[model samples]
Target chain A: MTRLRAAAALALAAPLALAACGGEDDGTVTLRYAFWDDPQRPALEAMIDAFGEDHPDIRIELEQTPWDEYWPGLDSQFAGEAAPDVFWNHVSRFPAYASSGVLLPLTDRIEESGLGTAAYPEDLYASWQFEGDQYGLPKDWDSIAMVYRIDALEAAGIDPSEIDDLEWNPVDGGTYVEFLQKLTVDANGENALSPDFDPENVVQYGAAMASSTGQTDWWNYAVQNGCELQNEPWGDYAVDAPECVEAIQFTADLYNRWGVAVPAEVTNQPNGSLASEQVTAGAAATALDGSWTLGVYRDGLEPGTWAVADNPSGPAGSGTVINGLSNAVYAGTEHPDEAWEFVEFLGSEQAQAIAADLGSVWPGVSSLNGRFADYWAGQGVDVSGFQTAAEGTTTEYPLSLDDAAFSTAALDEFNQVWLGDKDAQAAADAVVAIANE
Target chain B: MARLGTRYPSSTVNALNPVVDPARRTRRDRSTATAYALLAPSLVGFAVFLVLPIAAVFALSLFEWNLLTDPEFVGLRNYRDLAEDERALKSIGNTFYYVLLNIPIQTVLALLLALVLNSKIKGRNVFRVIYVLPWMAMPVALGVIWRWVFDPVNGGLNRFLDLFGVDGASWLNDTAWAMPVVASVNVWQYTGYTMLFFLAGLQAIPAELYEAADVDGASRTHRFFAITLPLLRPAMLFVLVTSVIGSFQVFDTIHVMTAGGPAGSTATLNYQIYLESFTQRSAGYGSMLAVVLFAVIAAITLLQVLLFRKRTVYDFS
Candidate 1:
């Protein structure tokens, strides 16, 4: 009977023993801040120190997941209800996370803190909002620009001045197509426009574009050529619209017909996208990539070797896709007040200065534009072209609750078209169908 | 505890001999209690980690969950949706192709390497370690290196083909070649690991049996078939079952190398499941697909086990 009572006691005591082994609790409130960039860690740490000076009671932990695994990692963390107190969020992914109520709405908190949405760029302020609720505070913004090497153009006997006024039209792609042809050189030292030029033996391509990419390449062309991605934000996809299809066809023809751009096989190789790589390799003269590429080009090239240019004007106008990154408080955070206080500090002038000092991203605060440009100047990269490009017509970065699903379908279908295995129109129709579904 | 034991007296206290050897019965009861106490930790861990998660996934499959949102009950909807999903069907087809491509080549190569390693050769231990090195390397790193090796313009494979006056096709970027290239990387990484198992099986085969075959005027080839092959069936079965499961779940290499592209040529069922669950935020649909995959693997493995049960010689004697 004593043994039986002891056994019963043991059963009851087991859970208590395990429960007693829970995490150690200190007096200070610990807030976890997660982001995906490796190069910006030091700058971010500096920002954290600056925040610590103001709120010494709050301890911050920084979690850095790589770009490819960031979203998947965050999703699993959320599923487990153990997501960080605060995390970096992209505009494209914000809608799904926000709509599902896993992101803490920040409108009332911002009002209480006396910091308005005016901290972010006027255009990007609405990007982090869903259903009239602000779910994120913008951290930084990215816009598309034409990144190029000067020596490659000079070697092809093309004046660098000509590229400044280049225009594109879906009908012939205008002088932009001609510029690509002039810059493209064959193995026999013949230009793409020369009579004896061999597409098979091409040595230098005019540009490199990842066929699977949307934001940095074809989507920009499609929108710039007068096509609406959808009826509205999170509405039905209109990828099969006539203007979009024509734009995509012209984009594909840059490789298949004109042989001025690197083939899909080369551009979308697993190592990295070919544009940034080939520009460094001197195989391609130019690349159309987001402002994010500025740091990559800066780190890769010799000082003054590469320069930025505004994306050439299409018939619609010189248009580009712009998006922003934001710091969002996880809805399940244990320390909401601390997380908000830390996030609030992230948008302040001191933190934006650190972002500028890193030279990786343009600050979300437009007032710091001169500092951002000056940082690039210190690195010997002329970034005025990006500013010029930003001055032109800008399109809203497409965001949807089903962006991943739509992107997967679009990548699969359009890749075939880019590879010359399927018709562009058919691919566009297939993407549209998948998007609607 | 003593009162409880007396209430439910041991079987030793039969009706004819009621109070016989109470001390002995208590000792037996104590040993039995100790046995259960010893097993409790593993039992508790298995219940919490394995059984509960699987049960949760099964329950989750019948609902609509976006990972972040509250789950809504939508019984059988995920399964119904998967039935009509063309991409899902295609991914399953691609996974089967991957399985077929990976298993046979690796098995044959492993057997051959095992045979060579079984012989008394110079630097045998060194060769064994050298062959297994690829398995030790990370999959993501291998994918990146292999991608460069397969590059059409400046890749080592293309450069080698150029020497033979042959034009190299786009290895990973072509729809016809992508799945095979991806599968070949798996074979490259795992064949040596499989060979170690075969080598162990070969070592276990009795030397006396081979001597008997030799004295019976059997040729080397005949002895290999008559003695070595039959005796190695257990190892062969282990390798086959494991490789099949591994092939079906291949994701990291495919993701790093192709990301289910050039087209949808290399998008296997596992990759699709990952995309749906994590990227598309459709955990419920992903769980349904996972259940289907589990069923397929279970049925196939069961069939294999049944087929090999009678054929495998577990005892050398």
Candidate 2:
């Protein structure tokens, strides 16, 4: 009887023991981190490597979803309760995720960890807060600037320095249009100013105005023209103001009326390339792009052939659309402590330095921001213009509770505005109604 | 001859001994049992994969669920919402427009392609494989390549047009051109697939009929109308039914290429469903859209079946 009981117990315990082991017999926790930007992968991998050395009990897995499909895919994953342990979150998406109770409340965790919030930019850091709870830590910052090709400028016989102070008004596009017209070369080797210049068969475009996301394109124009994106934070969209409408019309005229920029057919919503991609491909001479895309240019363009300059001064003076991404922990994450640990590491100055040294983007740690410019200087490209934009006038992308709806609605309406199928004021009103509904 | 409602059409039930009762009945019982056993796996699969999800979608349509929150029973509210939804209505119209543009042209082209390839032409086998290549490719990848080909300024189509001093229109971004461009892509990808069915259907028609036509001194057009056209019904029915259904559910190509834009000209119902479910996080409304899509496709399929049943002969054997 005793012998039989022993055998039975052994049979039952065998599978139990195997199940208990569960692939991590050493007790190492594997945290899945998801992000959308591919260019920032190396810096992120380096952060993972650095984190792993100090905490050998933790391992990290990185998931890279492209920007085009990222939010939609992430929404599905969140709905299915299968979101990554830690993922990059945008300000536009934070309110809905936080309000829906899908984001892990990090206030207690951040407080318990004794991590300093002073290292982060105040607006960006606070943007992730909801209902008196902190949900994310600022990871990086971005400011818009003009990414221009030096050869294109030289060929047009226009000095590159001349673009820094270029001013514009909604009525005539001011000196900015004239400056771009110089760089707009025709197939017959004549610029836009020449009588022989033909807009139909242009060999090279002067500028690329990406009408998809005006954050780095026309939003600056709107903000400089003293237009607010919304009535208030977490409020209805207010881009239908006359100043905002004029700014949008001016941006369109660059492609349609002035014909200096690349046409909307290839540079507007739904099927357009990024402004940075257009400049990198030499389809256009210059584009107003964000600091996050600096690495794309460094890797894409010939070294020392491209340089950055401050955005042109608008009617209300120069302004960059300042935005930043934060590291957010999914509330559904199985390993909450480890996910918190990873986010805390990402927010630290040490990790920020590692990211900064690569010159991919401005570091979240304010003290380390200048190091990003230094790294670019070492690469033979002066990127201080980005710093100037950041230091000078700036505006945040509109804050709202459910920007996913707004973004979809705006893309549909503004696409027509960019295509010249609908007027700016009408498109703005349509988008606002649909989004607010 | 085997008729429609008969059992044991080939006499396989009692091949060795015909004048038996008890033995034959026992064998028949065992055969019926065996047939049930053979069909069990696939029947189970059909119920689980198709029937269950469809039932779930219908149930989901009655709720107000966004996936992140708990579902609330709204009971026909989503349907009510659909009535007022402008985009939803537009998407339905857009899908019909796309099907009208795509199906007829693709079907006629596929038939012609199969007929030509079936003839005694040089390199016909190579042509068969070449035509099917687009069908075999990934639709998303093909959409990307097509986008490059249709780019307004730097596209091959425009550059080609420029050689003759005729500027090509902005094919994918123009409201007038967007639907046609997207529909053309569907036609391009699936025409060869449709052709394969027609080719098989053409081959199945014995050459004896054509020889008989030749003996009667029938013209090519007369033979096609009198014989070839009538005989290819089964394949035509299969291609037309499946192609129309596939065209109605086109999301990947539109998602990758136009994203239902150039001012909502290409926004089909399926794309709108994805937008509502995934982008807007309104899976309840999305499910209602899905149910509507299922009903539309099912009604059309039933219509095709009823139309074909009277004319189709299944027992060519």
Candidate 3:
């Protein structure tokens, strides 16, 4: 009788346990928004709070990942049909996502939200569009710029005005190289560029050529020199082209032939913090860093030491590579409407103004340029040159989701060139081989 | 039957029983057999986990699969690529160098520590525990601590060097020092574990022999060579074999310390396999490297066993 009673009890408890595990039907909608920028979290949170106040019926979840891990994580999530409703996208990575049908078309959303196409620059908007469908709404934009030590330039007896009229063409920019050489002084009484320059006793370098981030500055030169990274419609690798090789060689020569820049071995040292720690330690006079580095340099160096300038031109023309981040809805999102609504809110004038005010990024909308410039100027940074450089961009590469594999292969091949194991031409050819394969 | 028993011998009658006829057993008889029944669970486990997975890995190695897509068969291509791969070759060289660094240092240190503890020392157990503490710590945690200690800037090693006005070198970043630093950490962690084995081997050596050597006026070093070493040959062989295998398979420290960087200076074969499989999404190439590593390990282990078997003197009597 006791066993019978226990069996009946067990049978009853099974359904109760199952019921506890069952999914609930809450009337409130949940939206998942993913992004990679930790520095911009406060602004994003403020924007989301405003959106939440407007729509109390919706609940939003923020998924934050570091930029390196972001795309791969998103790719795996999309593959598993578990992607967030909205996520940050980049111009370089958008094409691969759009091609894979993972991004939701935002054409109708953009039209319906009353955010006219003209509000954002056409090229910026077109960068996020592919195959007649807009997959991403521009969130922010940026371009390459020269970051230099203002005091160092003045102390070296070189006028900063010399860089103002610096005409850059694809073929030759010897003047800019000379300027860098003149400004680079061995303040520690150790000559770094003279005939008696001690490689071991290098107290100061003239400039640092950025190499860790895929030789991005070199790519800008390549584009200016009439070398396309890929053929139109993004079909072929053009890194092996003579023009691209020249561009790559020119940047590599800054370290090798010119002796104006530090050795790649020293600058590329793993965990060495070469640029931030060593460069800001007053060891390097200049660095060809991204505009985003304004924040890093400001935090790293003493006040009134640095200023910004346009990148020198090559023989082809003066060029800058424009890149930006965008917000896109995941195609497999369960709450597509809610995701689109959030994306529209992100693109709104109010949100962009808030973003501009925070000085986090250059807001994508053209009308917000004044707000962004004023914000930076108020922070004691000269950002007027950045606006001009962004406007003068001649080429840009779409950051592909496959950049993890493609970039690793390319970087490994290029490391040989930096290490003096292979020439620039060979490195370029090797990169093409690896990328296409 | 009683009459037959009366007529036959007891031994003959016993032999005629059905239990004595082993060849005539049926399926049910075999199922009821004790030995086979006892081993059934272990046999099933071995078949399911070990044998089956090894077979599957062998099959997988012949295909080009990235886990995201269907695997396509491409026989010997992965192997061919492995031959030409400069990175894989460099890694192989690095792995051998690690083995060379680890085995001798670890074995000698372990033996030396065991000998010191075997003496008439107070608080011997306390010393043993202190020495073995590194082995007890989690490897990942140990790696993190070591990374800080070996850090080029603001590190313990650098600060220690600064006391003597010696400039601190980039221990983890400099290619020349990176592998040696990693090897030194491995030696530090494993010496105590190996020392335990040597201690056990030393304890088993009969005290009478050492007394005899002492009576002969043998020096401590001479006694160690004549009495202790010969008896500890088996322990030395065990240490060498295990240390060599462990060194070849080193991944964690290298992964944490370098991630095979500073121009691929410290990349080992195992690290390369990880990079190829996970980082590059080239599973086919990774599996090929894995197969090669397995073969190399197998060959080395077998060779060591054969070489050490002849050298080891196990008799204490």
Candidate with maximal TM-score: 2
Off by over 4 Å in 2: A1-26, B1-49, B313-317
TM-score ranking of the models: 2, 1, 3
Candidate 2: give the clashing pairs: none
Q: Write the per-residue lDDT of candidate 1 for residues A48-122, one digit (tens) a residue.
A: 998999887898889998766788888877766677899999877887888878899999998988896676777
**What lDDT tens digits, residue by residue, belong to model 3 across residues B151-176?**
65456988799889898876765678
After superposition, the stretches of candidate 1 with alpha carbons farther than 4 Å from their true spots are: A1-26, A211-213, A269-271, B1-25, B313-317
Question: What TM-score quantifies how close candidate 2 is to the native fold?
Answer: 0.91
Residue by residue across A146-264, what tens digits does model 3's lDDT show?
77888778777778888755544324446877676665555455343355555544556777764444534577778667787776545667788888888877777666666667656
Worst 10 residues of 3 chain A by lDDT: A4-13
Residue A28, candidate 2: how far off, in angstroms? 3.0
Q: Candidates sorted by lDDT, descending order?
A: 2, 1, 3
DockQ of each model vs. true complex:
0.35, 0.35, 0.10
Return the TM-score for candidate 1, rounded to 2 decimals.
0.91
